[model samples]
Target chain A: MRRDRIATDSGRDVTVVSRNGAASARDAAAFSTRWSYARKRQLFLGALAAPALVYVLAVAVGPMVQGFLYSFDNYNLIRPGSRHFVGLDNYIALWRDPTARSAVINTFLFTFGAVTIEFVLGLGVALLMWRDDWFNRIALGLLLVPATVTPLVVGLVFKALLNPEYGMIGYALAESGLSGPRGLLAEPQRALATLVAIDAWEWTPLMALILLAGLKSLPIDILEAAAVDGATAPQRFRLVILPLLMPAAFLALILRMMDAFRVFDIIFVSTSGGPADATNTLMIYGVKQGLEFFNIGAASAVSTVIVVCILIMAAAFIAVLKPARNRHA
Target chain B: MPDRARLSLLARRFAICVVLVIALAPVVWLFSIAYKPTSDIFASPPTLLFSPTWDNFSSVFRYFNLGRLLESSLIIAIGSTALSLLIGVPAGYALARSTSPRAIWLAYFFLIIRTVPPIATLIPFYLLMRDIGLLGTWWAVIILNTALNSAFVVWMMFAFFRAAPASIEEAAMTDGCTDFGAFIQVALPTVVPGLIASAIFCVMFSWNDFLYAMFLTKADTKTISVALLSAYGTKDISWGTLGALAHFSTLPIVVMMIALNRYFVQGLTQGVH
Candidate 1:
């Protein structure tokens, strides 16, 4: 039933149950390497890739698939399996409803607006920090603070600072020529925008760090050549820098966009998508319907749609990233 | 290389200093609120200078019981990170050593998983955790985080271990190391940096998480992230406790990141590349 083949430190033993009868696979890989390059590399890579694969299937794919399928059935968590096939029922409900539409739009708006601002701000900051200098110490320390704090705290902190009556934001705004007690999230129109700004403050550093690394790795010759050609600063930035920075910028955009669409913690704490559902993103709606309302089928539908959207986005990124991956391969 | 370069560098550094101030203003304001006397919190000009006191800090620690919440957070953080590594390392190793096409799909699936929103199965996961008798317990959050973040660990560490030399394991094997033994005795010790990086990230995600912790947990099982939020985000909140806990909540991460800046930045950049 068991092979007591290996022991670790602390005397904890690991059973080596040989799958397909190759001990460690390295021997097989070694044998193949001498005779067949492809076989050896594949085996070597396969071994390296297997753990991540298992994790994806077990924790990720299983739920995503089940969640998708559950959409087709009117499966309620409270009442497990009454099992009626709703053909496009949830889809119709979501599309036909205005509230759902607002949430979906808000989700995309949050993603696009927040990530755009963050990318610009991040690039500006990263460019400022590109050269080695004294700013490195304080800048690194300061910029890194926002991303390091837990999101929930960020939400609460912003909630306090932005609250009217006593919050500092109200006092500051009054000092600035604005009227009294503007609900950053209390007003229906400004609620989503307010949440978007919070995300920008929190995550712009991510964009900066990525761009800074990319900038660090750029070949200096091109920039020097541009300067020698008597290129102006803006001209050099627009032509030489922007094109080269596309890869990292696009990568940050994709990442930030993905994260922004899933805005939950801050919205949950700050506005709860309030003042007429202006700030409610899909995640919040999913939580409200699925968790609070116990409508698993509708939630499943939302989950399925989200998966499709993510897949589409990921497919585009894969195309973007494919060249780099192939070069590495 | 000359005065012009020096000037540009100085200008660049000044700009960076401004950006740094902008980035850190919100967090610094938290401390300002924490240390300022209640009467001085919202003075007309907004007092930037004040005598610091322990009243707020003491209240946060004692009355708010941030200490207990910190304990809860530490346990869950360590538990999730450990469990993630435990499952992830072996799984990553298996992928690296195996010759299966399934590995490709598995790795891609992990990537896809990483991209998908966390709320996709919030209700179902809650129901499942509840079904399994794990709802509202500390283990519930630990297991949830482990499951959620283990894929990231496996993927990142897989690349690390895959790049590892197989000869050490081969030499160990011929000299009486078993399959698992060759890995542990000969391989794992050298991969500590990767493991440490992945562990830090795992801790970061599990600790930073608010949604799952908020939705799946009760008061006793609540983490410091929740504590931090409740102080600032709720209707019953006050500025004094919010600032104090904010200091404590952020200090650990800031210290860790500063100590491991290179590793932290490198890990972050790797996600893009």
Candidate 2:
């Protein structure tokens, strides 16, 4: 019976294709068309895609080119009338600038710290909520709150909480003799760590959700087989699950790392890259150069460095994880 | 063995509860502060219990012109979302249906564009907007945001469209429907859920943006995020009013997430799968 149905389906397909061929040839002859049907279809697809491609080129690609140019020239927003080329001056200046050096170092420190902590915490929570149940569902719903809140709001909320004078956490810590009077954000030594903590607080939920999805989709047969073979839970996870989970883990890491490298809003509102520039990452430094100092060239240069750093990091991540991914596959 | 397994399960449940509480504490604290009276705001070891007051809310509205900022935010968010969808949905459909290698490359191009940090484009956008005299206007913010969001929309909708079956559209075309007509009539309705999900994400990102809004907008067109930041920068930081403003800016997004919780989760997990 299945073979008979398949024969009829093929007969229908052949008739349909012949009908389409006749219709297309007639239509082409009537219109004196130069393009084939497939070519026309390709043109239609290209036309459909043109608008977005044009917009991205104008807004993203064009600016990227202009930003590259701006980095090498003495382009200042305030002194727009007196623009001149100064090849590599801004880059050279950045190398000599202590603040730029500190910004680069601080950016790495913050990204590394935040991504590592968020991954570990996110994995832990994901493991805890691996089972699908009413309680776990509610917990996951609650987890979505932090990730959904605006970063700016998170920054403001933490700023209020960590206020050295009468803020709740600050007061509690001071009273308990755990911190000094300056509090976390105000202390030069602790402000960067505080920024990392705040970032982790807001984004660890996102990491958890992604990792949870990974855990949920993991092959259960292998896990069960290992269990039946008398393997311990830790041994099973370490030997089998961890290798399979690498792709998801790497994805979460790359995303969080890229975002962490561009850390701006939270640091902008909470510390303003201060308690004496302790938390001045590349983003804040770039904005300060452009808007605050009106050093557009230097700002563009800083942005160039940031883009290069991100690309290198992403390339490194893909290189290291590709082999693992291939092995799993 | 069963007893040990049950004990481990209980510990896992406890840990989940702790994680949830930690995740929610800051938001809860902000809400607490927003409703507290000015006197209660600075009480040593901030007061958790107080007579709820509308004073902060009133002050935020009365002094900050938060209503206008809210309107600006709404306009920019909705405008960007609409523009992104208009430009992205068709592009996404085309890319999904095209068997050309160039189409695949174009899809990857959009993904790469999505990864370029907004700061990289800030200076040029600033300069170009100034040159065009679009500085400090809603159109400038809307256009730039639309540009940013279009990449994301295309990326996401490409996935959605790829997952949708091609046979249905092909059947429509074979039944005398033009390609565009087939896409509009047959392909689009199937991806309504994906469209809605992508729209929500676009709105969320555009509304929550701070850096671009901060640089691009002037006093008249300030978004709530930038307004809140400026309010914080004042020497005499009014904690109560700031909290109220924070709540005002965040409540809509939180509510939307809750309302569309399942879709939002599905969107986040879609790429992973």
Candidate 3:
């Protein structure tokens, strides 16, 4: 009778109905069998997810909350006994702090400079390698080398190459009449620009790869239609391809911008934010405060600021890009 | 016009060649320096032609105990990858199956964790590990890396599992398999490629980590990256040895990239998509 009811409800052939009805009924029965069974499935799925949730809570979220609280306290690792609540003094000090202000400015400059150049160059390369050919494939493979090398190691390699006297790059640049004696990294005026170049080199391939994927998956019919309308390659690319590529481009921008804002490993090994703080981005400033100065409260405040800045950037990107995403859907 | 188009194509190819050379030159120079004899490393204009020496490799191993550092790095990376997979795969599967608003929020929570700078977490993590007396241990780095990598793992595998059809697991359940059994037996096999890709990524992230390893570990548990930084700091600059050590540290990941090129590209592109 239940099978008949299912067959009638589903409105299928009788033979097919019997098989599916049994299967569907079995599934329903499985869920219906003791509340314990339904609850068991829920428990099992929840249990499966529990470990990651617990781990994230313990490690990521817990540290963030603790860091926020620490920002309000005058806690120094070295002088643990002197720890006391300061309540926004650290944040207030940030307004007057020259070094902190410089770090924030430098971070913005680096993020914008690096990500912008990376996107432009990455798009160029992606377009160059748009065709699927042996040469392009090989080029793409070789490109991954820089992107895969550890950032710390990349910093060391560049530092060695830029070592003023005997360094390959510094020697070449000096011989070419490019800047003064201390080399690019040491020159206060040029240090940040050089760092931006290094960052662009390291990450542009990632941008290219992401964009290439976007280009590959672009609607061929649309491009061909544009071409059929007597559009030149450049016109077609500008009119059709660029708009289609915006979502990927924006995604690449967001990822690279967040990373650029948090840039540390390279700067740490190469400049250590010097040539007299010329390269002291926010991460470097925060690390210097917490680790070198042992001023936990100030470092936490810097961290809070960095987090807030990242959130603002992310929100802005989402706000701008979400509509494009929705329209496509 | 056809001639002009062909000329443009040639120009594009030439430009790409220049870009590739620029991209690969520094790495090639590092390798060249690593293989050169010590005296040749300081030679004016840097000699490209020389009898390569294993002395740098031997010296690094002798002076730095490269084996122990490699061991520490491997232990931490593998431990983190394993733990991440253990915790993250199930969560990914759950996220894939779930349609609840809570699940959507949970996904955002994972994304936010990944997006936040690691340094922001480092202060509290450093203090927390110090207070718990876990600082400078393999366990400390391992746990921290697990925390970092698991978020990524969950994010990557969440997409993977979502893309996979749910019908197989449903069929398995109809065949009298328990919910857990269906997941283990049916769903897991289907996403093996994704599992491998995510594992490779987790290992790379952990192995390449510098900030956490720098802050968390001391002498006994120091990873290769920290060791490389210290080698740079020693009084007499051994360019050859530094290059050799850098090469040694990067070799595993380089090999992985080459071997798993397809999967790596897929994983990266898929994440963005």
Cα TM-score of candidate 1: 0.85
Worst 10 residues of 3 chain A by lDDT: A1-10
> How accurately is candidate 3 docked according to DockQ?
0.52
Candidate 3's error at A270, in angstroms? 0.8
A298 Cα displacement, candidate 2 (Å): 0.4
After superposing candidate 2 on the true structure, give the runs of residues whose Cα lies further than 4 Å from its correct spot.
Answer: A1-35, A314-329, B1-6, B235-237
Q: Could you give the TM-score of chain B for each candidate, in order?
A: 0.89, 0.94, 0.92
B229 Cα displacement, candidate 3 (Å): 0.1
Better of 2 and 3 by DockQ: 2
> How many Å off is the CA of A66 in candidate 3?
0.8
Q: What lDDT tens digits, residue by residue, belong to model 3 across residues B136-227?
A: 99998898888878988887888788778888887888889988899998999988888988998998999999899999999989999889
Q: Give per-residue lDDT, candidate 3, residue A105.
A: 92
Query: Which interface RMSD does candidate 1 score?
Result: 5.7
Q: Which lDDT tens digits does candidate 3 get at residues A70-136? A: 9999999789999999999999998799988999999999999999999999999999999998888
Against the true structure, candidate 2 reaches a TM-score of: 0.91
Looking at the true structure's interface, with contacts defined as alpha carbon pairs within 8 Å between chains A and B, what fraction does model 2 recover? 0.74
Off by over 4 Å in 3: A1-42, A316-329, B1-10
lDDT, model 1: 0.74
